[model samples]
Target: MADHAGHCSSSSQDRRSHFLVAAYGYQGHLNPALALARRLARPHGGGARVTLSVAASAHARMFPSSPPGQLVVAPPDAEVSDGIISYVPYSDGFDFGARPRTAADRARRRRVSAASLSAIVRRLAAAGRPVTCVVSALLLPAADVAVEHGIPLAVFWNQSAATLAAYYHYFHGHEHLVAAAAAAYVGGADDPASVTLPGLPPLRVRDLPSFLVDATGGEHARASIDSMRALLEIVGREKPMVLVNTIDMLEPEAVALRAMRQQHLEVFAVGPMLPRLQLLQQTDAAGDDEGRRIDLYEQDDEKGYTEWLDARPRRSVVYVSYGSMLGYSRQQVQEMLRGLRECRRPYLWVVPRDGRDGDVERCLMEMDDDDGDGERGMVMEWCDQLKVLAHPSTGCFVTHCGWNSMLEALVFGVPMVAVPNWSDQPVNAHLVEELGVGVRAERDAAGLLVGTELAKFIAVVTGDGDEGMNIRNRASFWNQIL
Candidate 1:
């Protein structure tokens, strides 16, 4: 086995391996896939060459200054390398980040992406750099391309193993049971029934992945359930190896791995899949290469945020951010502001102007105008979350409980006030509480996490009380172990 320092012997075959990681264009999907690509490109991780593939829209966003040809639709052989991993873009039939309005539009994206990826594979092989494996981050078309090309495939499960287990059982043999439980709960059942899957703890209906029980049946909800079903179907038919983004110590029982392998599926827990500061230092020592971290959105000035944190007292600032893909309503945002003001804590909050709602922009502008000199609060469209969490002044995280955010909070030893919204966030929030590292705030009947509840949970996580101390201690323990 290779040590943390990448000191391990590799076979000649390992050195010749080239991994093509095809990631979905979303922020949550891109982060872990990029992290894994970086790891595989390292000397300790088989010293393999890696190529990251995403839609042209995301590629253009990440490298906006690239030439027009590269931004629109990259040539089959066009690739950018940051002295380590290579990045290539494939057209997903929606280069401007437009969502598909119909099923046919969705299918067109898959077809276009598949064709572009296949071209890239052939082009690489023609240049004597054939991809030895394909690792997909929920990009379904990548699986078809790999199969068509006869290359080994692996799916990167970018959520907790527990959620993976829930999805597995929900598809395998427990669909009826889960559906019944969810329906009953939604119908105001007093019991709020629990589901006991093999090799795992009993999970309440609320703890399951939100897509499974969402009553809205909106397009997004339907699309989510369909995506999960297709992914599971591929798992069952192809039995490709799975690389989960979770720590073994965190999931001691390994319920997902056990359940999958019982039917001959291969799964590996390869995580704390975060950027290593030491690795960044090493990169710095080599040169001024700056592509180690990739973000789809432009970030706030690093010096400005770090300087603000440096001036604050140790363990005093509250860092609040909902992950990308979640846009809080104007009322919710106002309530959050009220809670932050009432808490009387210095805070840093991220509110991205994704241009989806004009009201949100007006609210954010109002907030900026109110906090003139940023003495009590600072608002950024987006900021480097890992840097803020790693700062000593950051005492607690008020987050949407995205898996990447949860992993960052845990690894940085920061307690959390989980305000999960949808998808796997609810499951991640449940695990946060189960791990004793955070408190999940209770929401009102309309699923609004109002000001009082938010303020109370913030205090519970960062206060001097016994519960706060225990949560902080557990967070520290996990941090050390990782």
Candidate 2:
């Protein structure tokens, strides 16, 4: 295997090779991609020049005040830097924040973004900062552009290694096995079915990635399957390196890494890819003290959640957030509120107002009215999640089991009550339980977590019972190791 630095030139004049780190427009994709770029640009990590490229819409949201001229499809002279890493926006055709609604729309966006990204590469090369390598966070167009330019490419798998292993094996040879398991379970099997992949434990049908299990169901599910298939095909044919967003210690057996290695692919575990705020503070560059994390959506500034956390006792607060993308149904929201109220713990909940349905908003308003004193709970549109998770008073995280959220909770030693919805969340929730650091809440026939069930899991995670203590101990153990 080649050393990462070997991808750059050895000549003194061209020593500082540029790396183009491209991520999807979503917050979950952007955060870890930005973290990797920061690590590469940092003095100790590599001291390389890093440019982070995202869809124009996300870039615009991150830097809303930038001049129109600078946000052109491939602005050659536009150089926006956060002191450490440069920022670039490639036109994904849907620059107005509207998602691709159909197959044709997705194809058109891919075509447009591929051209825009190619132009960016050419412009960078002409400006003498040629991208030595392209690191894509599951963005297919970036991979296409990298291949078009003959530059090295590495995939940044932003999910758990176990999830990656599942996808890889599902595509490589075990498709039928996984499909059969899911089909049997869905067809009302008496016992739950499981698929055992190489190097990893048996993953039950319910615990596998929801997209793979329901690959034929919806537009989103089909699209996700297509993307994964495309990504795996690329890795299989070209054998490009893969960088997973987890530590070796976390996945000690290195299941996915080993599986990829057997196929002659170079896979590296480079993760817990979190913002190094302390390291950023020591840098000479002048940038945001928060490690230049790009939040595409507005955050709540009026709510003093942090100050409220400070006043709470140690390990006493329940922090609830369903991530930026997942919106709860009205019933789900009401049930969550009821559960939190029943838990009787001071809770900080982040429910973003954008994209929320009218019914959900009304429920939130009614909950606010009901809790006039705001003594037991505080609900905000959004808050800095890392701050909330790292707070000393935060004891439990009621989360949707997003990979980033799971990593943060693990890093902070906060036990979780996982309520997985879709995509890789179920697999992440499985990992959460497998590690003994959290418990997953069971949903009813309607796939809704009732108030009582939610309350029960929260108590199991945060209570003084033996099970809760064991979960807390495991969380602390992993926290120290990570």
Candidate 3:
């Protein structure tokens, strides 16, 4: 293995390099890649020219240039799954925190488009920083470019490793099983049933997200899944590595799964990266604070939900968000709105307005409950999530169980109500429920939200229920430097 440090050159005459990251235009993908780009672009000693190439329109807003690293627009060819960040402000809780939905045809067209990656790379090459390593974020075109340039490629798991492993296994000749299990998964109309993977422990059919298999009953899904499978299978052929954006302690199963498959595919769990990234931002905040405030939000929303915690008691508000990319049905969204209304508890909900479909403001106005206690609710399209989790006023979290959101919850030691939307959320939800950090909620077909389940969820989150709290408390305390 070649030491990466050996690639680090000090001579100013030598052309500098940029960590070319493919973020695929979603918050989940772009956010992490941006953080990494920022990390790599940071100077070690005194002087070093650097660049951090990002692929989002919001980059200029969120990451203003005091550090002066490069912020490239996500190009056309860079388009992975979907090409555009919908006008839908990437809100939380609404559609399980996903970017707004678009037609499959447009998505397919965008996926095959060749405008972004090459242009960005060409720009970097033009900027005197020949692109070095390529990092792909599912849709981000890093892998394709990596193959083109013969540079090392690292596929970033924007979600959790558990789902990554499951999807990886899907491509490794589990097509029939995936197809069958996917049918059963699509059969959400029936009673929830368990389906087992060959190398995995038993999991419910509902545990698998529909997107992992061929939902179209066509080659695109199969080919896409197969492509990902082929990518994972042969990643080690060139001693390529897989980077799981979680800490070792957060998910042992994902870590174990990676080890089982191959040795050359090294798994480095260097996160929960956002927290560390935020911590780094704070470290750098003392002087350059004025120019680089975190941007990319409605002006008023700069005030975070957790800021309320400054006055309230510790762990008081239930912080709720479903990450930035989990899709949800309309019924599910309404259920959460109504359930929170009934729960009568103070909460902070990152509910994105339907930027395209309808007036999200209408949805908010319609769900208006005169609970009277300003404490009962705080809703927004998006929130500065980490600040909310880290706030002392946050007592509990209700989430769709995206690994990033889940780990952030756990890292902050907040108790949880886990709603496994799709992907590895089921596994993470079970881990949380079984381990005592959180509890799962029941759902119905159409995937609509249920209040009775929400009642149980509320009880569990509020400490009015059973043994779950003991686990959460221990986890919380463990996080307190113990």
In candidate 2, stretches whose alpha carbon ends up further than 4 angstroms from where it belongs are: 7-14, 66-77, 191-193, 254-256, 276-290
- Looking at candidate 2, the ten consecutive residues that score lowest on lDDT are 6-15
Write down the worst ten-residue block by lDDT for model 3: 82-91
Could you give the C-alpha RMSD of every candidate to the true structure, in order shown? 3.2, 3.0, 7.2
Candidate 3, 221: how far from true, in Å?
Answer: 6.8
Residue-wise C-alpha lDDT for candidate 3, range 414-446, written one tens digit per residue? 788888765567767876765577778877855
Candidate 3 local Cα displacement, residue 392, angstroms: 1.3
Q: What lDDT tens digits, residue by residue, belong to model 1 across residues 252-350?
A: 765346777888987778897876555555555885442256787778898898899999999999999997777778898889888998888999998
In candidate 1, which residue pairs clash? none
lDDT of 2: 0.83
Q: What is the per-residue lDDT of model 2 for residues 307-363, given as tens digits with 9 covering 90 to 100?
A: 788899999999999888877899999998888989888888888876479999888
CA lDDT, candidate 1, residue 110: 84
TM-score of each: 0.93, 0.93, 0.76
- Model 1 TM: 0.93
